[model samples]
Target: MSANLQSAANPSLSLKKRILPVWNQLGMLIILVLLCVVLALFAPYFTETNNILNILKQSSITAILAAGMTMVILTGGIDLSVGATLALAGVISVMLSNAGVPAGIAMLTGAAVGYTAGAVNGYFTAVAKLPSFVVTLGSMTYLRGIAFVISGGLPVVLQDKLFIFFGSGSLFGIPTPIYIMAVVYIAMFFVLKYTLFGRHVYAIGGNEEAARLTGIKVERTLIHVYSISGLMAGIAGVVMAGRVISGQPNAGISFELDAIAAVILGGTSFVGGVGRIQGTIIGVLIMAVLGNGLTLLDVDYYWQLIVKGLVIVIAVLLDKLRN
Candidate 1:
């Protein structure tokens, strides 16, 4: 009874000890809701069902990249090559499709290529002990070069209806990209929550030396983490190709910035070791809402870029506050 009274008398202490820890995740959710409400009030078509679905569809590619990014960051690593890898996969998939390979097979091949790229990143970052930033940066440059070389700095257009449908088709009033996003999110959630790999990821990010001491296959796990990142980018690439009905070498430029921004905005610390799929989803939606809302309001594209940069800055500030 005395303890309860003392606690009640010290609400500041309670808030400091309690409210701070969970605010990182909750702050984004609250901000997202507030943004939605604001958009609904001011932006035409903002709250409409069609526009809502459209936003989800538009966000799918970035969300997919962010999902893979969550895994890489959880392992105290980064992959700057995703956007380039995406472009490469997209061109390769389209090339294969043009060469008479089936659409499904071509898509699979694209994902495999992404996986292969990631494996190389993992090898350098983990086995060769190179910094992830340096390794992925090099990969990013070479991969973009490869894309340009293969595509001759041009876009490859495919005439296949099935290939186009992956990006443009819908099921039960939802876009195909939405379905792909959903599947990717679900699988990521499961992998992060119920698997040893998930645990190891957190452990490594939190403390690599401790993880290595515990006999975890740190190098092998880091490789998988990056490979997964690459594979996700590949999937994004294929979908992007479907959307344009072509593979463009310039596709996904600056996309790595968006993916990394969303992951961090979702409350994943840049310092590593703390994040969740749910937060990432919220972050994805927040980013989508910002772009969609601003466009509806006729904000200039250049200004939108500025706003995005400011939002990232704010998000990082909030992260600092929360931590």
Candidate 2:
């Protein structure tokens, strides 16, 4: 029976070869489902419709932020200022609403503020040739400082109903934030899949010098990428203001960490240009489910932080192995 044993051992090895590709492609999705299943088993009401909706609603902000982060990461850059930009934008939007500006105009103005901030970041990185990390790190500090200065260190309460609807209201019984999340993902997916800009982003991430040599406007593209990231942060700020019904300077603290974690967990390369929008959303869902499940299990918030950090480390390790 030695011959039979040898054949059986070979089959197992063959099976591994067969399974690796699927695991690489659907690993995050599989992890998400397993997490859901385990939580359902151990956490009471974890599978309830209301709880599921709550998870989606809570994840919407992170999902929105991760969408922009995907582009930035694909280009082999990072934006540490998005969280600060969110806080500043939220504060501005709320202040404008309090000043009796139309909700639409105020929201747009807040987004514009984010765009300007991102453009400045891009300029420093592209034109000044400073590292993205350094530029955004500086931007993060100054932007938060400005938010506090303008608001005089006080929260601006949002009173506009229309503004609140974007955060709190539902359509066809689905949360409005969920709808916004869907739209952002859909648009991002289209842009990354079909547009020339998307190709350029990938090219840059793959090899910046080569892309430039091939006639890509590397400088212009970087500016646009960072600006998009800022705009998303700005939009997220408005949503947060609506949810909390106030603009707090302290809002979105450490949000950048979560976005980066989600992006990495979704299988995006930390180095850049090696991931998809689809994977990022799955990563976002995995994080949301993990957090929600932990809360339901009465896990301490501090422990949850530890767990999240560990998850990020593991994800990076897996990414390295895959690459």
Best by TM-score: 1
Q: What is the overall TM-score of model 2 with all chains considered together?
A: 0.94
**Residue pairs in clash, model 1:** none
Off by over 4 Å in 1: 1-11
Model 2 lDDT, full chain set? 0.92
lDDT of 2 by residue, 173-239 (tens): 8989999999999999999999999999999999999999999999999999999999999999988
**What is the Å distance of residue 89 in model 1 from its true position?**
0.4
TM-score of each prediction: 0.96, 0.94
> How would you encode candidate 1's per-residue C-alpha lDDT over 103-135 as one tens digit per residue?
999999999999999999999999999999999
